[model samples]
Target: MRSSSVLAIVVVLLVCLFKHGNSVPVEMETTTAMTTEFTATESSRKDIVFNSTEGEMEKPRYPHDGYCGHLEEACSDERRCCPDFECYHSEGRCIYLMQ
Candidate 1:
């Protein structure tokens, strides 16, 4: 019985992640010790936070063609993106603005 419940939790997690693009379970059964473990893990995951600092502040994006060096995919400053691409700080990804 306990093993089946654990397997169900694993199945639900994978189904939500791959088919629904969710990181957390939408609903859970509270009748088992495993539920408490899941709740603790989920709450702990949510408690984690990221804090940005100074000098490494995000900047605008710029344009550059291919060169001798390997181009970085992440955006941080003005030169990180192309002319049409803007650095979306909240999402931490480059977005095309000129389209």
Candidate 2:
């Protein structure tokens, strides 16, 4: 009877250890996945400027006429404008104003 009780205790301890060990790896995997996703998102935010000698154009005048309204509008029209009116190339977006 004593031996049976000891065996049961050992089994329970092993089960607890296995559960805890499995959880640690799962948590680590989740954290790594989140970090990878964040890095991919950050890289995508960077603008890809195309420079070709034949079709390349000079930088437009700063302080575009108006707000870009949307990122696509600014990129498609090649207008350097930002929502905050800051005229500068930032992250992959254009800031329209000087300040």
Candidate 3:
């Protein structure tokens, strides 16, 4: 019985080899880099605000404590700190709480 099972396994292996041994390797198509002209207008560039003191005071990117509070930044009861952060009133700064 064991010899017959071994013969059946050998037959299956031979069948698989015969089916896949004649398979051809497929050639992949080569990609070519295409160049395109990109023109950016002055108005479009003006929309982005950089690290300017005037711009930060006038228009803050994250209002109402939307962003994470830094160590030096001021935080109070009225102005809550970011997630997993607490307002250290003694130092008047926001601090990250460890889990």
Q: Rank the candidates by lDDT, best first.
A: 3, 1, 2
| Top candidate by TM-score | 3
Maximum-lDDT candidate: 3
| Cα lDDT for residue 37, candidate 1 | 41
- Model 1: weakest 10-residue lDDT segment is 61-70
Cα lDDT for residue 32, model 2?
Answer: 38
TM-score (all chains, Cα) for each model: 0.24, 0.26, 0.42
- Residue 70, model 2: lDDT of 39
Each prediction's Cα RMSD?
A: 20.5, 11.8, 10.1
lDDT of 2: 0.50
Candidate 3 residue-wise lDDT at 91: 83
The 10-residue segment with the lowest total lDDT in model 2: 67-76
Winner by lDDT between candidate 3 and candidate 1: 3
Which tens-of-lDDT digit does each residue in 4-88 have in candidate 1? 9999999999887787655556786575444334444654344333336643523322225321111234566433554455666
Residue pairs with backbone overlap in model 2: 81-96, 82-95, 82-96, 85-97, 86-95, 86-97, 87-97
Q: Residues 13-92, candidate 2: write the lDDT tens digits.
A: 99999999988844343343433343535433432223476666433333455324333333334554533443334354
- After superposition, the stretches of candidate 3 with alpha carbons farther than 4 Å from their true spots are 1-19, 26-68
Query: What digit string (tens of lDDT, one per residue) describes model 3 on residues 1-99?
Result: 999999999999999998797685668988698688977677434433455765553322235554445556787766666545678989878888667
Ranking by TM-score: 3, 2, 1
